[model samples]
Target: MTILDRLTGFANPAAALRRAVQLFDSGRPSEAFPLMAMAARAGIADAEYRVGRCYLEGSGVPPSRVEGTRWLGRAAKRGSADAQALLAALYVSGLATSEAVKGPASQRLFEQDTLGEPDFVAARELATKAAEAGSATGQAVLGYILTRGPGPMRDADAAHRWYERSAAAGCAEGRLGLALSLARQGGLAERDRIADEVRRAADAGLPTAIYLFAIFTEHGLGVAGDLAAAARLYQAAAEQGLPSAQFRLGLAMIEGSLGDLDPVAGEAWMRRAALAGNVEAAYLLGERNVKYRPPDYAEAATWYRRAAEAGHQAAARALGSLYLTGNGVARDEQEGTRWLRTAATSGNQAAQVDMANLALQGIGEADDTTNVAGWFEAAASSGDLIAAFNLGLCFVKGVGVPRDEGQAAQWLRRAAEGVAEAQYMYARILRDGRGVAADAQQARAWFAQAADGGILDARVALAEMLLNGRGGDRSPEAAVQLFERAAAAGHVGAMFALGALHSSGQGLPIDQVAAQKWFSAAAECGHGQAQLMLGRYLAKGLAGERDPLASRLWLERAAAHGIVEADEEFAEATSG
Candidate 1:
């Protein structure tokens, strides 16, 4: 006999398989897998089933669902009980429909037979065939169909009988379903017994069973709570690339519920889940990137688009914002409005607020005050802070609403409580006695708060008030400190104020040298007043030697920049 024939022990087929099974049981599925493949090729029924199972589970190499289904189909046709059960299970679970199943013949079957009508008759017939061959998984699948009735073949009694048989054969899913059904129907004692059987089946490697068991362990359902164990089970399923498990594991890592939170690892898991087409993961990744690390705007936009495509309202709004602001890509105002409108139609409050702003400003299209007011009202009704601020502006200015300073002040104060810009504007109202009694001390406090939040205008205004004693006590030294800070941050008014302070020696040592340098720097930065002052100092040699040419040049520039006194200075410097 040939060596292959000798190994099979048709001659030695049974003995060879026994040895392969021994190797497989000893964790040597690498060697066992090839031997099983050889036996399968030799038409050993049990070896065919084992080989297919190994391929399906990727026990010895990368998994091939298509190859696994084909081998299982061949073994099942030969009446192998294990193969029949596994094949039926795969079919019922939809895992058997691999890329290979998209061939013309399979497509025809799908379009003509499966898609055309409910075919419980055919499904039941196939299921019965596998069940009759002593396949527990097949019996369980048949039970599920009989209970649910894909067509007109509903029979709960038949379902119970099949489920009982499958449970007796150690099918974990069968036991779990039976237990859940019994629990729903008030058979509490039976439910408890079946739940234990389901646990045993889960321990033996059934993926669905493992997931259910994890849920039970985590929630302490009919068992003591064990979060750690539940986390481990979820991780195991995630490693197998199950999308739900991956999402849950990522959430646990992000929330630190499973231990120390790791944002990087959580982001990795979230990305994997998003790639697997989880809408929630896509939205979460987008939001996280937008809030924390916007350097990944392309990725953030992609995730936002995915969620938006799936009809997530918040994601659509976020995508609109990105498009409007050109966060990670070229700004497209038209596209931004489209997304904003989509989200607004979906009742997104933020989108309504944004739409109002865009409409009022004619940002992406023509101004539509009617639409703007409508969206603003909608946002305000939903308690949007920015919308309230905008509404106040509208009322105060009579842009789209009647002018009403009382209502405006009310809304402005509300927005100001949380927003720096609103705070500064509201402070102006109080300082100027507009619809409120003037309160210099309160105005200064508000200005200081806004300034501390990086509002450059607020800093300059506060510095001016301190320097001139306009709204509060005069403090030139304090004003100089504030002006210097604001000037360094590129505030033109603050630069002029600082130059004046150095030139006048008010609350500071007179330093003509420092004044000339400040004026020159400020003038180079396009501060008109500084340009005029620097030209005068250069022409008169107040700080150093005269440079009429430089002085005349600066004076000409200042005149062009709208400094009225610069024309006369320029003429005088040029004449001298």
Candidate 2:
């Protein structure tokens, strides 16, 4: 049976109070109200507090904030800490003590004409009484007001004393207040020692304490780190409707920053927090959706727009990219440039680089090297590799910068890490002695690295150097291997080099068939000399079986492409 059922049998104030609590917990505030009212009429202080709360919240009654204030005033006089704090909050926030009403405040009965006059003076007096009556929350709140000095004299010392007393009474908010008061200097306790106090208050069911306790657990502040435990606490606090907790928990779940990754749950939490105006959550949701497998650009734009409206610099840049690419919205270069400018003003490094690119390409604005260099320098200083490459080029050519090959090499060297183009450039500077002493050995090393890193031109250069022994020990065999690799990556020069190598028999055992095969491959790629050579090989059976028709056809095809030797050879063959 419900406590109310048994309490009705007892017909006593104590039983009535207990029954009211049970009903309130059961979400039956209407039922609890009558019992609380009955006890309140009998002069029970705690019951008076319950009556005031019910009226203030309009539990099973029309809302009359004026009447609620009156009841709250009575409860405060009866020494209810919550009642005192509520009244004080109303005054501190400058809420109309008696809110004007229109109709249907059914939960708390309020009358339009009976609106109570807003009274800061009464609120201040009630707060004093509540603090003197040992309300920890009231004392802490009074301490905050005293320290703030809103229309009064500031008293940091008195505020600290009140906060200390509130904390001693086991109030988590009081503990936080005291910590903040001392933070102006150091703190009341060492960082590790304060954990105990916070945990104790959290155990007593304080929201702020619970959040701090979760943080301590996550980071091992004063306890062994336990991220899963922290996540559980975050989940609990999020369910309790804490917005900041919801955003953090959402991120943790999304990134699996804590144990038990749940992307779906994480996204749901982010949506909840975002809807509640959490800018970070909004930005993260935008980032997540944009990077999702197969990407959902439209959805990402919606979230990005929300965060951008709140002045998130990165979101402005991201949205601009989407606009420019026509990924989520219509392609609009002007719009994109506008957003890039916005982010540039905030000194967003990537956005600055993008702006530089836009200016250089003449896409959104006129191509101007001065503007481009300025933007590139801004981004490059932030260690952007591509920006460094572009900036290096600018220094080398005096394009929007002074001609300083040494500076160019400096930036190029920094950008040479696994970047084929940069590697090639660095190697070229070293090999040619451009604004520096030529180091053929170093150049060869860089050329090899760049070739392997996938620069076809570097591969050809390295192969030629190897064949001629210009940079290091001559190795025709190694040169042949380099040519083969470069040709495989579609370099026409490498293909020609391979044909020459096979024909001369410098790298491997002489094989006429192999020579013909290399020549044929090069000829197919429109190498005129290789075409003539292949035709001669076929005509003389030097590389394969003699076939006059095939040879003639090859020479004729080569002559059509304006190869001078092939045309002469064709005329000679035709006359013979």
Q: Per-residue alpha-carbon lDDT of model 1 for 342-409, expressed as tens digits?
A: 99878887787788787667664444455665677677757777887888787777766778887777
Model 1, runs deviating above 4 Å: 1-217, 220-278, 281-303, 321-333, 350-362, 367-408, 502-505, 508-514, 568-576
- Tell me how far the alpha carbon of residue 327 in candidate 1 is from the true structure, in angstroms, after superposition: 7.6
What TM-score would candidate 2 get against the native? 0.60
TM-score of every candidate relative to the true structure: 0.52, 0.60
- Which digits, one per residue and each the tens of the lDDT, describe model 2 over residues 1-576? 356564672578778888779888998887777787778777787777667667657895655455566666666667777878777766655543533111223533434523344455655666677788788888887777777645564578888898899999877778877766766546434666567767776777666677778898999977779998999888877887777788889889878999878889988998998888888888889998888999999999999989888888898899999989999899998988888777866777788788777766666555444667788877777777789888888887776778999999988888887467888999999999997889999999999999888898998899888988987899887888888988887787787777777778777677778888888888888887788888888889997589788888889888988988899988888888
Q: Best candidate per TM-score, number?
A: 2
- Backbone-clash count (model 1): 5
Q: In model 1, how large is the Cα lDDT of residue 17? A: 77
Q: How far in Å is the alpha carbon of 319 misplaced in model 1?
A: 3.8
